[model samples]
Structures are given as C-alpha cells and as structure tokens.
Target: MAQPDVPDCPVDALTAECLSRIFSHLRPADLAAVACTHRAWRQAVAGEEGLWRAHCEAEYCLRSPHLPAGGAASGYKAAYGAWRSEFGRYGELAGRALRAWRLVEDWTAQHFPAVAASFGMGASEAELDAAEQQLGFALPPALRVLYRVHNGQELQFDRLVDIQRTAAHESIFHGMFGGYSFYSHLVSCRMLPLRRMVKWTRTAHTQLDFPRGDKRALFAASHNFNKMVYCDAADGLVKIACVDKENCLQAVPADAAGDPARDGALRWFEAYAAALSSGAFAVEALDAENPATIGICLFPQLPPGRSEAVTEGVRVRACPLLIPELTQVAEGERQYFFAYSIRFSLLPEEEQAALRGTLAGPAGGAPLESVQLRSRYWRIRDAAGQVVNEVRGEAVVGHYPLLRPGEGEFAYQSCTHQREPAGSMEGSFRFVEGSLQAPGREFDAVCAPFRLDVPDFIF
Candidate 1:
C-alpha cells in the first residue's frame, strides 16, 4: 500500500538544516541578499547565529594577521587571545580592529616630542587632559581608550607619504599622470610630469616634492576606504593607481592623450573631490544642522553612444526630511534620522533609450518610453543589523550629459544632514510609455555609504 503524502509545513519549507546547507553554498553578500527576500528566510537565517559568527571570523582573518580556520567559538577565542596578547588591553584591541586608533603613540613621541609624553607609558590624567586642551577637541573615544590601555606599545606606525620622491622629474609628454597623498584630513592630488604639482604649489601655496619618482602614491585617507586615482593626458592616454595606505607615491604613463583624456580626468577629480568634502565618504559626527555635502567628480560609465560630447547636464533631485529629533549622544555620538527622496532625470533621449534597453533585457527588461524613479524613506540598518531609523522622501531626479568621451558630471540634490553613520536606500522607479501601460521597475541606489568623519581642524 502506498503511504499518504505528508502535508507541507511552514517550518519544513526552511528548516534550520536546510538553511545551513544553503548558506554553505553562498557568499556573505549573497547570503545577505537572500536574507532580504522575505521574513521567513530572514528568521531562518537570523536563527543561524553560527553563520554570522563564521563570517566575522573570516573577515577578521582576511583583514588581520594569519590564523587557522575553525568553528565560531574557536575562531572567536583565538582572535580574542591573539588580540589581548598583541595589545595587552581589550580597549586597545577593539580600537585597532575598528581602525579608530593608529599605531602612532611612539611615532608621535619621536616626531612631536611636546605631545609625546601624554601618549607614552605612565601618562597621567593631567597630562592627557592638557593634551586634549591643546588639540582643541576630544580625542576619538576609541583612541582615548587605546592610549590609556596600550600606553606606549606602538605596534602600528603611521605611514607618511614620500611626496618628494613621487613628484620628482617624471616624463610628462609621454602621457598625463597623477598622484594622491592624505594626511589626517588633507588629501592632495597632482597631475603628472609632476607639472600640476608645480602649478598647485605655486597657486595653492601647498609645498610638494618628489624624492623618489618611481614609488607609487600613498592611499591613506582619514576615513577607512580604498581609493583609485586616474590620470588622463591631453593626447589620449589614461593611467590608474590604487592607493591602499597613507604617504604613498607612484606614477605611470597615461593610456591615451588629448581632449578626451583631460576631460575624463578633470571630471573624475571633481567628483572625487566632492565626495571627500561631503563627509559622506568618511567617518565623523552626525549633525543635521552641519550636514556634510558630497559630490561625484566623474561619471566614466556614462550613458552609451555619446562619448564625443563635451558637456552634459545632469539633474539631481532629493526629497528632504526632518525627523528623529535631537537627543543626547548615544554611544558617544549624536543620533538623528533624516529621510530623502532621490531621483535622476533629464537624461538624453539616446542615453535613456540605452538605459531602457538594458533594463528591458532578459532579467530586468521592462519596456518604457519614459521612466521616473523615486525612493521612500526606508529603514536604515547599522553594521550590527539594528534598525537605527527610517527615512521618507519623494523621488528626486537629475540629468547628466556627456560633452566628450570619458567626461561627465553627476550633479544631484544633497541631503546628508542626518545623524546616522551609514545606511542604504532601495526602491523602485515608475516607468511610462506612450502606448503601453505604466509599469514600475525596482532599482537600488546607494546614497553615500562612506563615513562622515569629524575634521581635525588645526586652525
């Protein structure tokens, strides 16, 4: 006799065992995407605390020193022990992992003797107090704890860029090139042939020297993030460099020359500079009244079929929000939640057609004659996966045109005056056609995922 079929149960749809098996086959980001699919999946995945723990361990291993792989408990124990042994203080270990404190206690003593004692061993409260007074602002909380715990155990030294070497005599006519260096809150960029450095120094009164022209540019920024620098020559050459640490310097010949390259480089620089200034690309205090503004300097991936144009006008619109009233600092930082409705529009007919075609392809292809997209104030999740706040806004759009190949602007509305460190927004766009029915297509746009760090203003 055949057995009766078992009815499907909700738990059976996603049992812990099944979910674990599925997770093993996917990456962290992929797992995150899957988790966002539905509440059931989210609950199942969330229950598997082991998954997140393993992910954290893997990340720590990759970013920190070498370590053997094991279960979450083993990895955590090993990491904790290693950290304690290296730093001799829990606060110090945590600070280093968070990248809030540089291993500069000793370096500070060596270079700036006046402030060295306060950071050295057996430092007194009075000494630290005095130092803080002199600096004008309180030291980052993590750094403060690290200094108190580690004292003078200087394991990580601040890397200074060798500007003189990178700026020295390099071939200019071969093609356009550029270099970048960051110290604290300052980021300096110069054109190749090292000519731009000369112009910048003369015009901006910023001294730069190239001691070693062969070395690469330093990649250190105040906030933790990798940056890529590109140089386009007047002829048509393009050169690119990846900056990983501070005080780095390097040079390379451009890939092309002429107007196209120059325009591209200039556009990119503008966007990059804007991003840097906006505080959206770095860590900092969240103050709505003093909201940070970020800009995109270049749009190399411009709408296709219009590479020869010299100038393009891009429109950016944002719906602003004023909510999450001011409250005392939590976790030593002020908290506020602001929402924005962001949109991009005024795209050329050709570019719009290209976008529509691309969207209409096999996976996301949805035919449309006109498309207007907007995002509501969705919830913002912190690194801990906790809902910090919600954002609400209308759809704001911007139009960007390409005047020439490899050059364009990404001008848009700026509403970064919220008290949250970093949050992502996702929504859908409404598409319309002359003859077809209006249809909506989902799109995800990243509003500045970078940190907003407080500036260490010397003046």
Candidate 2:
C-alpha cells in the first residue's frame, strides 16, 4: 500500500540530510513506502544508489556485488528488473522461494541475531491508519497485514558497504529504528554518514508518461537505479518503469503474454514477498559451502578380466551413472542404496530392427520390452582390500527390458551392504537377445567401479 503522497507532519520539519540519515535504517519496502510521502524525503533516502543496491542484495539473495550480466546502469532498480526476469526461468519458483525464505529467516536468526532483530513485529491498527492517511489512499488488506508482521527492517550493513565499517559493525543498534510508533518514524535511521542523495519522486509532469488523466505515481523508487515501482490506479496493479533524467517514464513489461506478475509486481504485498524470496535477494543457499559444487575427480580401479565384451556385428553400449542418497542408507546394517541409470544408444541396426520387430509384431519368446538387464551381478571389496560381498540377480528391478537404438534409458535401484566404513562396488549387466537365426546370444554391459564412503554429516 505504499503510494505516492505527501508527508505532512514531523518528516516535513527535518532537513533533507537529516531525513536521509534517519531513513537509511528503514527496510527497502519501508523506504518504498516513504518514497511517495514527499519530494524531500524521497530525495534524501530513495535517491541513494548504495541504499537500493544494498536493498537488492539483502532482499534478492544476490551473492555478487558487481552488477549481473545485462544489468541496467540505473543501478539496483534496473538490477532488480533484470533479476525478476531471471527468476522467471526457474521451475516451481513460488515453492522454492518460500522454502528458501524460511531457510534465510532461520539462518539470519541463528547467525546474525542483531541484524535479525531489525525484522520488526507487526504494526498496530492505528499505525496502519497513520500510514494510509499519510499516503492519502486506502491501504490494501494484504499490505496492511504485511506491515503488521514487520513494520520495516533496521539498517542493512551488508548492503551499505561505504558506511563506517568498524562503527557500523560494532554498533548493531545504531541503525535500528525500533520502538517507533509513527509510520515516518520507521523510515528514519541514524547509522549512516549523512550526505546529499538524488530525489526519486516525480516533480514535473514531463517526467511521467502515463496516459492523460492517469493517476499512477511512484510508491517505490530504486535508489540511484533509474527505475520506479508504481501503482496504476487504473487497475490497482503494481508496475515498474525505467526512469531517465531527461526522458519520461517507460513501462517495462516482463512477460510476452503481458502478465503483470511476470513484470515483477504480483501485488503490493505479494510482490514484496516475491522480492524477499527471490534468488536475486538471497543468492547464497546456506552459510556453509559444499566442495562438491566445485568439482571431483574419480580414479576407480577395475578387477582383471571383468571388463565389457560385446559380440562382433552386435553393437550395444551401456553408459551408467549412479546417484546416491544418504537417506537410502540402512541404519542398522552398513548398507548403501543408490539409483542408477544406464543409457543404451549404440545398438546395431539389425539388432534394433530385430528387437523392435519382436516388440511390435507379437509377444512370442521373451516379453521384455521395458526391462534392461536379463541378469546382473556385483562384487564389493572392503577398505582392507578383501572381497566382502557378491550379489547375483536375475532381471534388474524384476524385469528384462529391450533397449532401443539411441533412445533407450534403463533405470533401477540397487543396494550394497558391507561391514566396513568404506568399500568399492563394480557390476555388469548380462543382456540376452533372441533372434530368428540366433536363439540365445549373450552380451555384457559393464558398470564402472565406484567407491563409497560415509560422511560425517548427512547435510
């Protein structure tokens, strides 16, 4: 419900520099709310580049400080626009955003308790009324409820890099705007070094390009970024536009289908929530880093005379990959479970034709069109180099599948048990084919030797 309006009381009395210092502590969403209050307040805090950029980093989870590829020169606002576009590429975005935000909230509370304290508790009815009156507009129910949850965050140190490094870090309470009863009081912070910042409000009619008689105005301004988030009175739809010092505002549509949510304004509160959960707001998934994300080199050893062998004129290739899940491991016994997928793409033409003909013509000899292995076996060795176990099975996953040329993938689950903490496993799939000329022909598809070791912690 942050809309363009004039600040009437206490905020009107403060000097622009004083206002900026106080407003610097407010959350980005709160800052957006204040941006519409008046020209002076907007110029003080909403115009600062560092403010918007910091807000972007903290809200979007953006790990990189430098502008992302194709980021707008307008700074955080354009960066946010670019960021929203990137989020559209992900699947199950809403679910991921919610889960990720929950993780972020937990992490902040545990690791950065002082900063976490900035996330304010909900506002009161009077406070909501005050905010609404200041804007000369009715606050939406969702937006009112949102502010009630957290009036605004305290100052964000991670976002404001140029601030007093030692002092800001040492005094966690300095930038905080706690115990403030009024809406404008929430916008004021005292931690920053005071200075003049640019104005984000539209002062002249020439700056806006909305249709004649259109009542759209800026509710949120991207600090130093030449972009503004506005509310279109025509539809109550939140929207974003590029700002040019010399030119008029230009609306930026996010989706080809012209969906406003895709452009990043789902709703005032919903957009704020989306922004809070977006990948751009929180780039680091967790505080700890995983070494596996970098890279891993495997040097597995194979047993002698245990390699793959295919008959002449009958070409079939099996390339297997294993995915191990710690949850799949047995607790009582030292057992490891893994899902494996092997792709068969190099079957000979004659073999493929024979296989297809067998599957398509009629169910005659073997009804194995969906199964891959007729028989399979695995050999496991302990860390001490002793053969710990051997497993021989008929039909992987309880079925024998016929593999097609260049288009077939076989998947199955396997379990290996060992008494030792570490071990190695290697196996082979025995594929049996029956043709008109040759009744029974056997071929071997080798599974690469892979080592397994339990980690200290599952996560």
Candidate 3:
C-alpha cells in the first residue's frame, strides 16, 4: 500500500474555473504571489479576467469606467493590469500626501482647538461609499483620507471671517438667538457647513447652471470670501468659484493655484496638505466683533535672531537668468530639464529709519517679515495655447533670503521640466516689510519674461 501511494499535482491539478474561484478569495498582493507559482498557473490566473477585476474593485473601488484604454487586450484583466501598474507608481505618493494631511490635522488641533472641534471624527467606509455614489466619481486617495480624518474644516481668517450673502441680515443682534427663527436666519445667510457639504454640492451641481459640458463637479471647502473651493473634473484640478458673484458663478484659480510652485489645477487635496506642511501659508480664525479687541496681533512674537538681522538693514533685489542650461531627461520621453538662476540683493537704504517706520515701528526696530516673489503665476503654453506646465506656491525658494548691501548676491536655483518645443517664464518678487502674518508694505521686484529654447542636436 505504501509503495503504491503517489503525490498529486499541487495546484495545477485544479480546473481553470476552480482556480479562479479560489484566487477570488485572495487580495491583490496575495493573488500576485501565487501568480508566480508555475507557467500553467500564471497563464490560468492572468487569463482569469473576472478574478483580477474582482481584486482591483475590492482594493481601489475602481470599476470599468475608471479603467484606462489602449491596452493590448480589451478585456477586464488588461484594464486591471493597467490600473495595478499605475497604482504601483502612485500608491506611495498617495501615502506621503496622507501623512502631510495628518500633520495638518495635528497642527490645527494644537493651534486652533475650537475650529478643530468642528472637524468631528474620521469618516467611516460607508460614508465614503455614500459620498462616492453621490458624487458619481472616485475621490483621489489623499482627499479620501482627508475626509476620513475629518469631514471638512473652517479656514482661519480674521477681519473678513464670514461669507457675505446677497441679502443683508434684517438684524445681526436678533439673528444670534437660538430658536426656529434663528435657524431660518442661518439658512437665509447661506451658511455652508462641511457636514452638509454633499447636499449643497449636489444643489450647486444641479442648479448653479454652469455650461452644459462644464458641470459644477464637487466642492472641497467654502471660504469667507464668498467662494467655494471645488474640483474641475474636466482637468482634475482645484479652483475657487465666486458663489456670490454678480450674475452666474465664475471660477478662478485658488491662491495655491495662483502660485508658480503648484499645478495649474492646484491638484486640490495634495497641494493644500503640502502648503500647510511647508509653512508657505497659515490658516487662522477670528471671532471678535471689535477690530481693536481682535486677538490677531502680528507684533511681539518676532524670532530672536530676526530683529538683530533686520536692525542693520537688508538690501533685496531680483536677479534673472537670461539663459538656462538644459539636459536630456528619461528614456523614451521627449521632456527636457532646465535649471534657472535667481539672485537677490539687499540695498543699503533698507536700513534707514524711514524704512524702519514702514516695516516695524521706528522705535520697535523692524524685523523683516518676508521677501516674496510676486508675479503673474508662470506657465508654459504650446502652440495651441494648452498649458503644458504651471508653477505654484509662495516665495522663490522655500525661505526668504537675507542679503547684505553691495558685497554679494544670494543665489538660488529654480527648475522647469517641459516636453514642449518652446515656452517662456516670468514673475516678480514681493518683499514683505514686516512678517508673513502682519506683512506691512509690499515692494515689487520684477523679473522680466525669458524664453525657453532647445538647440538642434549636432550629434
């Protein structure tokens, strides 16, 4: 009996349909592991379109419509393969963006507890599923994580802290009471709370009446400026729309989108998280009615070394790179990488008492606030006027430069990666007399527009 015993074929013995049923129970990663078992198993699993599709759907919530086209095969398995490949490239990036958002949450809770309290708890899977169903599109991963941590939040702004509606309040004092009449008053003002964001967004999408091809898409946040920050599904970028504009709703680039360091669409969630982490901007709130009593004073918190550096006077000027050096990029890609130089100079006059008065008080000894570059946001356009690339963010480099008079210039490098044959770059530097929070007078130093060109290859 022992001599007659024999081993059966491991997994290859299973029928294709049986194998598919078994693999369906595995996650995407587990499915991948078993795929390398044997030639027969690999072919059997790879060809099982339904199995791969099920894995993709379970992991990413991706359906047929969300899949990419032009694969060698026009089956679900090919689409799943394409998505898996793209996920491999972008998955880590999505994680980094989520980490950045979590940092922002921690910062907000520590610095602005009252505002943070309104954020609530992280979203549940069912809520996310409902939101996706309602929006009719899959949210980007970072944005999904952002909502899970907190449904939405209020940004900090001092003087202009509330969104203005077209109808003025009958009586501001009377509207403060808590009752049925107060509830009606709140609705009349068009207050947009993040928890009910989906409802208002649906209304905006259906009733606001953007052009036929241009839907209102989805809203990310509502601002005190009578604007709702929303996504343009047409471009997958974020834009700010004037909700209380004269006539129809008009959308414009959000502040982050206006910066040269950002994508033209501002790529919404990721860019916002990055901006918070980078200290390029701060979100603060104000609730006091009296400006004099407002708690948002910008003085008295100057960094220790800042006052000493500014007291001597710092000269600041803009230096442009008329020519940029270019290098060939990756294989099979036509893009070129160019590096441009920017130099800053601090003039002797920056130390004068008149300058001190404008910056800090003449008696206080001015501590420099910021040296920012302000210009029309830069972009590279092709012959058809399509934006090949757009830059965004604040300041030329991440930090403000402190330069001395006449001795030397502070040099920094900026780069642009473009596939276009020709394009140009231009912008100006804005010097903040005080600090970022309480910026005084802003002085503009312009950088004239420069051409981006590539010569014919000799070799």
* lDDT for 407 (candidate 3): 44
Cand. 2 TM to true fold: 0.31
* lDDT string, candidate 2, 260-333, tens digits: 33322223333323333332122111101221111100111121211222322122222121112222233453
lDDT for model 1 comes to: 0.32
- For candidate 3, the lDDT comes to 0.43
lDDT per residue for candidate 3 within 322-360, as digits (tens), equals 111123333454454444444465544444445665532
The parts of candidate 1 lying over 4 Å away from their true place are: 1-367, 374-377, 397-411, 416-424, 431-459
Residue range with the least summed lDDT across 10 consecutive positions in model 2: 178-187
Native-to-model Cα distance after best TM-score fit, residue 116 in candidate 1, in Å: 37
- Candidate ranking under TM-score, highest first, comes to 3, 2, 1
Off by over 4 Å in 2: 1-46, 58-372, 433-441, 456-459
Query: Against the correct fold, how does model 1 do in TM-score?
Result: 0.23
User: If ranked by lDDT, best first, what sequence of candidates would result?
Assistant: 3, 2, 1
Candidates 2 and 3 compared: the better one by lDDT is: 3
